[model samples]
Target: MTYLFNQPSAFAAELIEGFVAANADKVRQVRGGVVRSTRSKAGTVAIVVGGGSGHYPAFAGLVGQGLAHGAAMGNLFASPSAQQIYNVAVAANNGGGVLLGFGNYAGDVLHFGQACERLRADGIPCELLPVTDDISSASVSEIEKRRGVAGDLAVFKVASAAAEAGHNLAEVFRLAQHANQRTRSFGVAFSGCTLPGATHPLFEVEKGHMALGMGIHGEPGIKDTLVPRADVLAEIFVDNLLSELPAGVAAAKGQRVAAILNGLGSVKYEELFVVYRRVAQLLASAGVTVVEPEVGEFVTSFNMAGASLTLMWLDDTLETLWHAPANAPAYRKGSVIVAEALSPAEREEPVQETLPEASAVSQQSAQRVLLLLEAMAQQIQSSAEELGRIDAVAGDGDHGIGMERGVLGAVAKAREVAARGAGAGTLLCRAADAWADQAGGTSGALWGVALTAIGTALGDQQEPDASRVATGVRHAREGIMHFGKAQPGDKTMVDVLVPFSDHLSQAVAQGASLSDAWQQAATVAHDAAQATAQLLPKMGRARPLAEKSLGTPDAGAISLALIVNTVGSLLHDKTPV
Candidate 1:
């Protein structure tokens, strides 16, 4: 169980602060995450790697001389926001372009892809490389869908080495993809990890059983079986990896591979050595030679009692890059020249945003929007645990907490802006920023996009009428579908959002008032959310275990329905004809 935290919500930030304080020799705190305390050569490709923050020694811990230039760390067990990714990438970018790398998770994909687009729009070249190396997450035919596990280390190492060797952005990205393709990881957990301040673990296992292929986020594994002896466990790991050698590798015999026997949090080094001993014997018996066999924690899942084995099958270039000298806070390879640490940079002053002019009617409408947001925050807070339970059935169980945090943040910002007589558009824009910044996950990004898109459609200068509001909702739906690449049947929030938007637009066209139209649309959304229980998830993390989510609605879909319904109730009392 994890302890030692002030507020559960503030844990990731505090951990980053302490990490920077302890490793000042190697890392410095940046807006989104950490960058190298030591300056880098000009025109060198920057390798920016990150994921959720629970995996220490992975993101920030790997930011130094020859590894990642910076890491955009996210909230615990959640992906970073696009703003965070963009900020870190901007801070780390040199004359050469930036290469973004992280695990092949849905939230990471959405945020990083958005950041890449933003960077490119601003004339900074950016590329993304998602590590899909865990074989257990998906089958051989859909290998690209696998979740990245400990194999992330191998991919990040090779890409960073390529960058250090003066490779261009394209070459760095290519090498990173090569490393990811050549790597495979398999893991087993005796138990699940407990988040800080949480009373129970995310999942559980019987005393004499083990979970096979469990994710690092405490997501239940694909299979469960009786616990085996250390040697037998080693056999399981080796046989699975050996059965599916990388496509280019002819056979395991006489092949060189970089092996990482990683302990996931609670497992000890001594135990890892025991497991690796058998692993080595098995590999050697197959005429395979292991190079630079690492036996320790690389990527971890809080205090989950589990271990994983990674095999990075090496070719000439990969082997050379794998052995390159590197230095970071937690990981170090061959001796690296000591680069003098620079003093921390002064914080930049915040630029004041000019408030857009607004009409009196829109300003009045903004007050109603604020009240709706407050109600949303209250309802989300009340139902968070239930939403989390629903999400845990098929995905990482953080939806409820994430929604509560985001809605509360949005409500707070909306209240403050409304007090200043801001218009509906301005209030919603500020609230959207707050929600995305505080939430820092897939839900955050999608909600941020939806709100921002609506704000854009409804100019502050005009009164928010039923026609305008319906238009804004349609715009929001389009933006979400384009950004998230999820359709109505994908079992995402889009499932409800599409129906709600269509119903609202149709009702408004038929001369319905805003309040009445919203109430009807809310009914459509509610039904759509409920209908999701019969569909299988085809997107995001839940896609791997679609069956497990059979009878439960998607957390995002359900939350959207709840918010719409809550807002509908408020509309009757507040919206003017």
Candidate 2:
């Protein structure tokens, strides 16, 4: 259904280019995303919000005077890489500090959290504000696990307003948290969305039936029922939200709230207004007051035929900030005093590092590493579609594309460094960085950790032998476990990685050659990956729809197995070690 695209991989980048060109007066393009064209006060808290690229108006469109200072844009339905988030935060930072706000999805959490640590290490004060507003994703008792949806707007607005009001980083973060606590959203979809160049939708709803509690990223709904009239749908929305008022709000009666009736991409404004009509009547009947209710798209999935209702229970402070003036490209509340635009020279430029000198033996090893990366890239490209199919059973179906992008980036970077006569360790490290930067998801971050750990274990000065290679692989496993926080039974990539690492280490310790040990370990990885089909996902986006993934191997685990197997073949055929 996404008819307009040059190439699937290039879609996100191209759209961002066009977006900046059209909104140049309001925002300017940065390395990873967009920042406000106008400069803010010297010591104000900078609000940097971001997520995957499909949700327009949510991210780049909200970068302006009274909204986000900048947004780290990622590939379609994938979180931006940690490097991307860091770049945006660095560019957006005023002298005070930076507040990173994003939906509480797994990928966003991993990438943003990493960026927060990096920012602090670079002497910049940074805090995280993950929005959890979707009531359908988790139980009230498990509110922290909820997925952020349309209600992100309310939290972003209030937090940005606090920053604009000259609040310090602590105050801004506190207000953001308060706003997140007060906001609740519920969404439904008439049909699923298709990514650009895809022949089919990620998931489909039965004809004449509508999905309830569907996610914005084309995730299938938890339940399905026959389509109902607009009034009935509105009633469903009101009843669900009112039944679970936030902890502070005793009841819906006499409560003043900001309501947002959001149309997810394909839903028209007219349809939303019709739904909002009944929503308003129901609220009034329940003695609840609606304050400046907005009835249109604020956040969206790319052309998903759905809508969501968000209620932000407003306190006095929240209400004042809600009513404050804002001027973004897509969202404008009231007139704002335009600030001076930033000149080209004021923007930050990316720093390039020079390649370090390497010994002849290490340079030869780097060539072998490049060959291994190229083979892995080819394997991932060939299997991407199948991997995506498996992921769509329960999670967002972008795993294949994400892996493909990541491996291709890694291969390209490896080739560049190997040509420059870099050592094996330095080449692998650079390739890992490129993979993470290009893919920008949970898998991307985890793979980056794995490769970096391996690179660190094998120093650039010498040719790594079988024992050293085994140690590097074991370290890779440890790093992945630490970074991803998933154990073997969690049905993630760790399921495969752990077994492979252990087997390889044991075999190498018993004096097996690197090629033989790797071949044996690849078999272990394959079995572990297949065994994941019987396990339930305990982490990431697949956790909520665990039942649906019952008979399918995890996409991440499968991809890791495929890569390791490819590497094993390469090692057996060519690499001396």
- lDDT at residue 220 of model 2 (Cα atoms): 48
Instruction: Give the runs in model 2 whose Cα sits over 4 Å from its true position.
Output: 351-353, 356-361, 509-513, 574-577
Backbone clash pairs for candidate 1 read: none
Measured against the true structure, the TM-scores of the candidates, in listed sequence, are 0.94, 0.95
Error of 1 at 377 (Å): 0.7
For residues 164-256, write the lDDT of model 1, one tens digit per residue. Answer: 999999999999999999999999999888888989887777788999988887555678999999999999999999999989999999999
* Per-candidate local distance difference test: 0.88, 0.90
lDDT per residue for candidate 2 within 95-153, as digits (tens), equals 89999999998788888988898899999999999999999888888999899899989
In Å, residue 13's CA in model 2 sits off its true spot by 0.8
- Cα RMSD, each candidate: 2.3, 2.1
Per-residue error (Å), model 1, residue 419: 5.6
Name the 10 consecutive residues with the lowest summed lDDT in model 1.
344-353
- lDDT score, residue 132, model 2? 94
Best by TM-score: 2
